[model samples]
Target chain A: MRTWTWLHKWSSLVCTLFMLLLCLTGLPLIFHHEIGELLGTEAHAPEMAADAPRVSLDRVMEVARARHPGKGGMFASQERDDDRVWYVTLSDTPTSETDLKQVAVDARSGEILTEPQLDNGFMYIMFSLHVNLFAGLPGMLFLGFMGLLLLVSLVSGAVLYAPFMRKLEFGSVRRERSPRVKWLDLHNLLGIVTLVWFFVVGFTGVLNTGADLLVQHWQNNQLAQMVAPYRGQPPLTRLGSLEAAVSAARAARPDMAVSFVAFPGTSFSSPHHYGIFMHGDSALTSRLLVPVLVDATTAQVTDTRELPWYFSALLISRPLHFGDYGGRPMQIIWALLDVLTIIVLVSGLYLWLRKHRAGAAKEAA
Target chain B: MSARRPLPHHGGRAHRHGRAHRHRPLWRWPVRLGVVTLVGLLSALLADGFWDVVSWLALGALVAVCVFFGWLRRG
Candidate 1:
């Protein structure tokens, strides 16, 4: 019991502040799409006839590239609910992760809608703080370590709960008692209540932090094998038609819709192929992606395969962490739970401080 | 705020009432709530509509329990 108490105190102290920041930032991020629409930054394609002749993906790419004169296309994707607009991301180089810009193009009319800001906005700030604290990969790993601490704290806290609650009934907050006692009961109640939730979200968050590493592994293993034939070939100077490549991918996976296409030389694609990711229409499978590699020069489907277990786990972890899976009600519940979590963190900190102060007072006397 | 103050004793009070008021097993309620919470978290992710509703209710039960204990009920 003493060891558990020591572990719980130290672990919770280490990660409490970061966890608080994450909960606060994550609250707003739960409604990111809604907030974006309200801010008028989200581009919506004008309504067109159901059977309207859609413009080719090539035309969409052209229009997006035209907006950013010298930038190379990195990715093109559409939202799951709205296929009317294609958002094309362009960077200085195909593989550059920074200084990227997005241009939204109407899929039917091939008209540029808006250049959505990739950085510097309310949601972006929240996202940066929540995801990586604006410090990129190192920051992400740091938070992941904090998340690990949070798990340790939670487990130790649970073990300690058995001792604390051995006498008191469940959820018995003796409010008439001292503030510390009230908060201690509240903490134990809310902590145990939110235990499973915090664990799921926290565990998935840890998994998501390893996303970049997992993708690199996939690139080295599966992607390298898929494009082995073109290992020594020079990068394609001129690419084949984007429309043809997409069409071939669609033909290859007739049951799935294209989620996004990673252009050649991007981190998500090899130098010789267009990594067109596809998704199923179901609620569950939509979160799981299947990658189809098409030859960038020939517009031919080179290889299509299911992602490895780790990659699929990373992909699934995204929605679980984001709380975007079950629609508006789920998002609201997620926010409420986040508020409750904030309470837990604050109360825990208070309990620790009060204990420390009392211990000091005792020594002084 | 005396550092040596006796911890608030609820077990004696419950025992004075009757055997019925005796504390339940320590892990009983926590385990039940944990299972409900686990169901709530996964149901929505697996499917929608009825499952989502199930998830909302299951999770909402925890919130409801918190409200009942923290605010509604008094010792």
Candidate 2:
């Protein structure tokens, strides 16, 4: 409809500048995974020998706690493919409140390879800035508004497309005329080609930025119910064997591998819960986490098995927005699309200015 | 602002019949409203200290200029 076209154009014109900025910054982010790999941040956890006795999770927990004596117990543990258990914990420093620490342990021998520390690196700092501009909640909400504007702009630009392209064909670029005409044509061509990717990036970005809200909702709703029965139950004094708990959980699932475990008393795992996180074999399914809750004392499986569709959508949107899901080829394609979007935004502004100037000249004549 | 507005004219130099002459008046109010709205938004964005304040100000000025052009074309 003409009305929709007008809405799209005006919206695009208003937000294209900001959208261009996001695209430029987002280009670097798509390759963050590859960059991390190149920077040697990837480490192999020691593998357990087939004949070696399996180390107890309690032993690994002991090493992690000894490293930070006065600190609280582990918040969660991540078991990598190479047999490393990453103990993520919280401890108070002399001057500050509780802070996060991640300690890597050899699962085969329960040896602490390194002391617990913050893992803030170059890529992480950039990632934080890109996501929230270091302004935290407000910045994320602002970016969401900008993303909304971009969606509007895309629609408006497409609407103006038919009117502008009525005479010219889809790919036509009028380079022979004034600079404005040439730029406008390029804008249209580039916008059309990259429309689908732009939509994917925009829609996913909205959902991704809304993750905090989603978590809070889940916590207030289902998580509350999961924890309700455990109320007034004796707080877990000492937890059960995590390996046994993980084995029990995997036995119940029959298909997934243990990716992480939230210990009792943590947010994800209440006094009533032992959050045994699992992943599927395939890449797509692997990204979807199914947190199986096991009773800490009895190692009895709770009803919390798989995530609902909304949560699954949220989980998948992270990779979709980042362009790391498919592979390096997808990253390259995302980067190219980002660059094209920048061109479209710049050219669109130029076209609008040129039209304004032409209108002024005609008025003077 | 009142002195700047051109007197409305029904016919122009290029027109043989008066039918094509009348439609130009319909563009006047829409152009003026669009320009003013654009300026208001541009000013708010500049006040917020988001990037491209200068471009936004320039955009505001452009819309103001377009408002003038619209007034000029009323005749």
Best by TM-score: 1
- Residue-wise C-alpha lDDT for candidate 1, range A1-365, written one tens digit per residue: 77888899999999999999999999989998889899998898887797788899999989998888999889999888778889999999887878999999999999988889888889889999999999999999999999999999999988788778766888899898899999999999989988888888999999888888999999899988888888898878888898999999999999898899999998778888999999988878888889999999888998989999989888877887888887788788888888888999999999999999999999999
| lDDT tens digits by residue: candidate 2, A288-310 | 78878888778888755567688
- Fnat of each prediction, in sequence: 0.62, 0.00
**Candidate 2 chain A weakest ten by summed lDDT:** A89-98
The TM-score of the first chain in every model comes to 0.98, 0.83
What's the DockQ for every one of the candidates? 0.35, 0.02
Q: What's the lDDT for candidate 2? A: 0.64
In model 2, the runs with Cα more than 4 Å from the true position are A1-6, A44-55, A66-69, A73-98, A109-119, A353-365, B1-75
TM-score of chain B of each: 0.66, 0.34
| Native contacts present in candidate 1, fraction | 0.62
What is the DockQ (computed on Cα atoms) for candidate 2?
0.02
Cα lDDT listed for each candidate? 0.88, 0.64
* Reference-based lDDT, residue A313, model 1: 83
